[model samples]
Each structure stands twice: as structure tokens, then as C-alpha cells.
Target: MYRLSGVVKRYRRGRATIDALAGVDLTIEDGDQLVIKGPTGGGKSTLLQMLGGLDRPTSGTVELDGTDLARLSEAKLTRVRAATVGFVFQNFNLIPTLNAQENVEAALVPLGTRAAERRRRAAEALESVGLAERRAHLPSELSGGQQQRVAIARALVKQPKVLLADEPTGNLDENMRDEIVGLLEKMWREHGLTYVVVTHDTAIARRASRVATIRKGHVKVAEN
Candidate 1:
């Protein structure tokens, strides 16, 4: 579902040129659970951005479901991301004011789904994340793990083909981390969703079908 061929991403730091990704060649198949592990500043987040159509590569190609993201117009890439991809962050990027249900429904607003249908789907999504009863709670009222669950619900409410998670377990305790990983595994199986998770946790990496480590600016497969 994802293919990156000789992908290079370079940026300027003052006058110095820095390469975030240097010739990264990687592929993520449909329904794959791929874990990307690396030290800080190794370009794992940049790679996820490339996969999600959030950033364009400086060179080479990033193809998602046969569509080359680098070749798309910004408007077209936005549409692709809205229609095909979902993202979860380590920080649980939920709005403080919006309740859990509203947060999930917000994702459907861009797709022009009817209000009633959006509500229904949002309820179902919350249920999937085991947050059905807490749908009315605000982010401030929830624990860190609960807030993360709300974020996951919001991400999955779109029914995206692929989910890009950047250090989803970074802000949680070990037990909460295990819970989140198990929840992701359940969702992947139920939705047949493709997952590319960028994390430094070895336990999370072990849960994936494939593991790749990024160092400096290169990608190395730990094992398949």
C-alpha cells in the first residue's frame, strides 16, 4: 500500500544542508503492521510525514495505493490524506473543549457526512476504542490513557486504509502502553488496516509483523 524508492529529504539549517532521509527504500503492504524504531532525530517522524502526504520528498517517489504522493497537487494530496490516512500522536492531540464524541465526529465533517450519520459512526468508533461510556467527557476529565484512547477513536472514526502512529506509547505508563498496543492490534485485525508505527519501544516493535530501524538517515530492516 506504500512504496518509497530512493526517497531523499533535505532541509536547510541556516546555510548548512541537512538530510533527514537519505535514499530510503521501503514498502508497506496492505494490512501490514510495520514498526519503525530509532534513536531521536533519526528521521522516523519525517518518514511518517512522507507516508501520510503531510510532506513531499526532496527527491524520489512516495507512492500510496498506486498514487504517487509527490506528484500530486497540494489540494489533491489533502484529499488523499483525508480519504485514505489516519494519524495518532504520542501527545493525544484532542481538543480540550470538545468532548470525545465531538472529536470523533469532527473527522467526518470534512467528508460531508450527514450529522446523524456522523453521530452514529462516532458512537461506533468510541465503542470500538472502549470509550463509549466516556464519550461525553472532556479531555481534561480523562486520564492520559483515556485521552489517548479518545485520540485513537478519532483517528479510526475515519475508517482510513492506513494508520500512521508516531510514538503512540511515549506518554503513557508501561501498563497503559501495553493497553494501547493491544488496542491497536485489535483494531488492525478488525479493520484490516495497514499500520506504520514510529516508536522506540521494543515491546511495541515485537508486536508488529515487521520491524525496521532508522539510523542517521537510512532505514534497515531488523527482521521480517
Candidate 2:
């Protein structure tokens, strides 16, 4: 579903330039569950942004489903992002003011979904994530695990083919982390979704179909 070749992403840090990704070459097949493990300052998150079309590579190609993202217009890229990808963040990124259902429905707004359909899809998404009963609850009223579930529902409510999760379990306890991992695996199986997860959690990496460790803007399989 994704192919990247000699991709480089550099940033101008005042007088110095920093290379976040240096000639990254990667391929992710449909239904591949990939975990990217790397130390701080490595390019794991930047790689995810490239794969999900959230950021353009400074040079080389990032192609998704045969289309080159680097060549797309910003409006075109926004359309592709809304249509093909879902994102889950470590911080949960939910609206504290909105209830769980509302938060999920907000993801559909960009797609211009009808209000009735949005509500229905949001409800179903929450149910799929096992948070249907908590739909009316505010973020502050829920546990950490429940809040993450709400975030997952929001991501999936778009029915994206690829899920880009950035440390989805980072804020949870061990048990909660396990729960989230199980939920992600189950979702991957049930939905035939491709997962690209950036995580420092070794347990999460172990559960992935493949693991790549990034260091100093390069990536390598941990094993030969």
C-alpha cells in the first residue's frame, strides 16, 4: 500500500540543517502490521507522516496505492488524507468539551457527511471499539483506557484503509496498554486494515508482523 524510495526530509534549524529522514527506502504491503521502533530523535514519526501523506518528503518518492504523494497538490493531498488514512495519537487528541460520540463524529465533518449518517457511523464506530455505552460521557468522566478507545473510534469512524498510530498506548498503564494492543490487533484482523505504529514499547513491536528499528535517519530490521 505504500512505497518510499530514497526519501529525505530535512529541516532548516536556523544556521544548521537537520535530516530527519535520510534516503529512507521502505515498502508496506496491504494488511501489513508494521511497528517502527527507534530512540528519541530518530525518524520514526517523520516516516509515519510520510507514509500517511501528512508531510511531503524533501526529495524522492512517497507513493500510496500507486499515486505519488509528493506530486499531489495540497488540496488533493488533504482529500487523500481524509479518504485513506486515520490517525491515533499518544495524547488521545480528543475534545475535552465534546462527549465521546461527538468526538468521533467530528472526524466525519471533513468528509461532508450528513448529520444523521455521521451520528449513525459514530455510534457504530464506538460500538466496534467497545465504547458504545460510554458515548455520552465526557473525556474527564472516562478512564484513560476509555479515552483511548474513544480516540480509536474517532480514527476508525472514517473507515480508513491505513491506521497511523503514534504511541497509542503511551499514556496508559501496563494493563491498559495490553488492552489497547489487543484492540488494535483485533481491529487489524477484523477490518483488513494496514497498521503503521510508531512506538517505543517493545511489547508492541513484538506483536507486529514486522519490526524496523530506526537510528540516525536510517532503518534496519532488528534481525538479519
Candidate 3:
């Protein structure tokens, strides 16, 4: 579902230019589960951003479903991100003031989903993540695992075609990490999502059908 060709992302740091992604070429098929592993400062997250349309490449193309994201106008790109991509991050990225349910509903706001429908979908999404009972809880009131579940719920509430997770289990303990990873896998299967995760955990990498190791803006893929 994703075709990235000659993708290059460069950032200027003072007088020197840094290449976060240097002429990378990758393909991610529909309903595929991929895990990206790399050290810090590698191009893993930058590549994820390209896939999610959160950032544009300095050169080359990032195509999703035949449309090049790099070529879209900002308005069209925003609509694509709202309607097609879902994101989960290492830190739960929840608003402390919003309750679990509200956090999930916030995702639908960008799509202009009406309030009543948003509530229904958010409720179902939370239920799917096993957070139905904690709907009223604030991020500060929930455990780390529970907070991450809320984040996952928020990401999936819109029923996006692709799920992009960056370091999703990084902050959790071993047991919690397993639980979260299992939850992600379950969601991927049930939702038929094209899942791409960036993680450092070898255990998570071992579970994937394909693993990609990226370093110094270069990427190498291997079958698990």
C-alpha cells in the first residue's frame, strides 16, 4: 500500500546538512505487518513520518495507494492524513484534561464527524481496546498500560487503512510491553490494517513477518 522511491529527507543543523533518509527505497504491501528497528538518529522515525504524511521528503516520492504524498498540497495532505492514516506514539500523547473517551473522539474532529457519531465510534473503539470501563478516566488517573491503550483507541477510532506506531512499547515494563504488543497484533488482524511499527524491542521484531533495520539513513530488510 506504500511505495517509497529514492526518498531523501535532509535537515539543516547550523551550517551542516544532515541526511535523515538518504535515497531510500521501500515497499509495504496492503495488510502487511512490518517492524522497523534501528539505533537512535537512524532514519526509522523519519521514514515513518513519510509514510504517515506527517512530513515531506526533501527529494523523491512517497506514494500511498498510487498517490504520491510528496506531491499533494497541504490541504489535500491534511485530508489524507485525517482519513487514511492512524498513529500511535511511545508517549501516550493524551491531553491530561481530556478523558479517555474524549481523547479518542478528538481524532474524529479533524474529519468533521458529528458529535453523536463521534461518541458512538469512540465508545466502540475504546471497547475494542478493552478500555470501556475506563472511559471517564483521565490520562493522569490511568496506569501506563491503560494510557497506551487509550492512545491506541484514539488511533483506531477513525478506522484508518494504515496504522503507524513509533516505539509503542518503549515506556512499558516487560509484561506490559507484551500485553500492548499483543493488543496491537490483535487489532491489526481484526481491522485488516497495514501495520508498520518502529521499535527497538527484539521480542517485537521477532514476531513480525518482515524486519527492517535502518542506520545512518540507509535501510536493509530481512525476513523473520
Candidate 4:
């Protein structure tokens, strides 16, 4: 569902030009659980951002479901991201002012779904993430794990074709990490949610059907 061909990204830092991704050629098929592992300063997060349509490549092409993301207009890309992609961040990016239910509903606004339908889908998504009872709670009112689950629910509410998770378990404890991974696995298998998880955790990488190690802006290894 994702294809990156000769992808290049560079940033100017003082007199030096840093390449975030240097000719990255990668493909991720539909319904695959792929884990990306790398050290700090590697291009894992950069690649994720490109795939999420949050950033454009300096050169080359990024295609999502046959649509070349690099060629899309800003407005069109925004719609594509809202309708086809979901993102989970290391720090749960939930709105502090909005309750869990409202946070999920925010994603549906772009779809122009009716208020009643939005609430219903939001509640169902929260329930899927095991946060049904906490729908009315604010971010501060919930524990760290619950907050992350809310973020997951917000992402999943779109029923996105692909889910991009960057350091998804970075802020959670071991038990909570395990719980979150378990939930992800369940979603991947049950709903066929395609996932590209950016993580440094070997255990998380091992859980994926395929694992790719990025180093110095290149893919060093891919193990199936």
C-alpha cells in the first residue's frame, strides 16, 4: 500500500547539509505489520513523517494506494491523511481541553458526519481500545496508559487504511507497553489494519511480520 522510490530528504544545518533520507527505496504491502528500528539520528522518524504526509520529500516519490503523495496539493494531501491515514505519537497528542469522546469526534469533523453518528463512531472506537468507560474523562483525569489508548481511539476512528505509530510505547511502562502492543496485534489481525511502527524496542520489532533496521539514513537490514 506504500511505495517509496529514490526518496531523498535534506536539511541545511549551518554550513553542513544533512541528509535525513538518502535514496530510500522501500515498499510496504497492505495488511502487513512492519516495524522500523534504528538508533537516534537515524531516518526512522523522517520516513514515518513522509509516509504520514506531514512532510514532503526533497525529491523522489511516495505513493499511497496508487496515489503519488509527493504530487498532491496541500489541500488534497490533508484530505488524504484525514481519510486514509492514522498517526499515533510517542506522546499522546490528545487535546487536553476535550474529553476522550470529543477527541475522537474531532477526526470525524472533516468527514461531515452528523453529530449523532460521530458520537456513535467515537464511542465505538473508544470501546475498541478498551476506553469505553472513560469516554467522558479529560486527559488529565486518566492515567498515562488510558491517555495513549484515547489517542489510539482517535486515530482508529477514521478506519484508516494505514496506521503510523512513532515510538508508540515510548512513554509507557513495561506492562502498559505490552498491553498496547497486544491491542495493536489484535487490531492488525482482526481488522487487517496495516501498520508501520517506528520503534527501538526489539520485542516490538520481533512481533512484526517484517523488521527493517535503518542506519545513517539508509535501510541496513530487513528481516522477514
Q: Give the TM-score of candidate 3.
A: 0.98
Cα error, residue 99 of model 1, in Å, equals 0.5
Candidate 3 residues 69-176, lDDT tens each? 999999999999999999999998999999999999999999999999999999999999999999999999999999999999999999999999999999999999
Please state the error at residue 150 of candidate 2 in Å.
0.6
The 10-residue segment of model 1 with minimum total lDDT is 215-224
Best by TM-score: 3
* Candidate 1: clashing residue pairs, number: 0
Kindly report which residue stretches of model 4 are placed more than 4 angstroms away from their true locations once superposed: none
Ranking by lDDT: 3, 2, 1, 4
Q: Which ten residues in a row have the lowest lDDT in candidate 3?
A: 36-45
Per-residue alpha-carbon lDDT of candidate 1 for residues 29-77, written as tens digits (9 for 90 to 100):
8998899999999999999999999999999999987889999999999
* Candidate 4 similarity to native, TM-score: 0.98
Computed on alpha carbons, the lDDT of every model, listed in order, comes to 0.92, 0.92, 0.96, 0.91
Q: Residue 91 of candidate 1: its Cα lDDT? A: 92
* Per-residue accuracy of model 2 over 122-213 as CA lDDT, tens digit each: 99999999988999999999999999999999989999999999999999999999999899889888989998899999888988878989
Per-prediction count of colliding residue pairs? 0, 0, 0, 0
Candidate 1 global lDDT:
0.92
For every model shown, what is its TM-score relative to the native structure? 0.98, 0.97, 0.98, 0.98
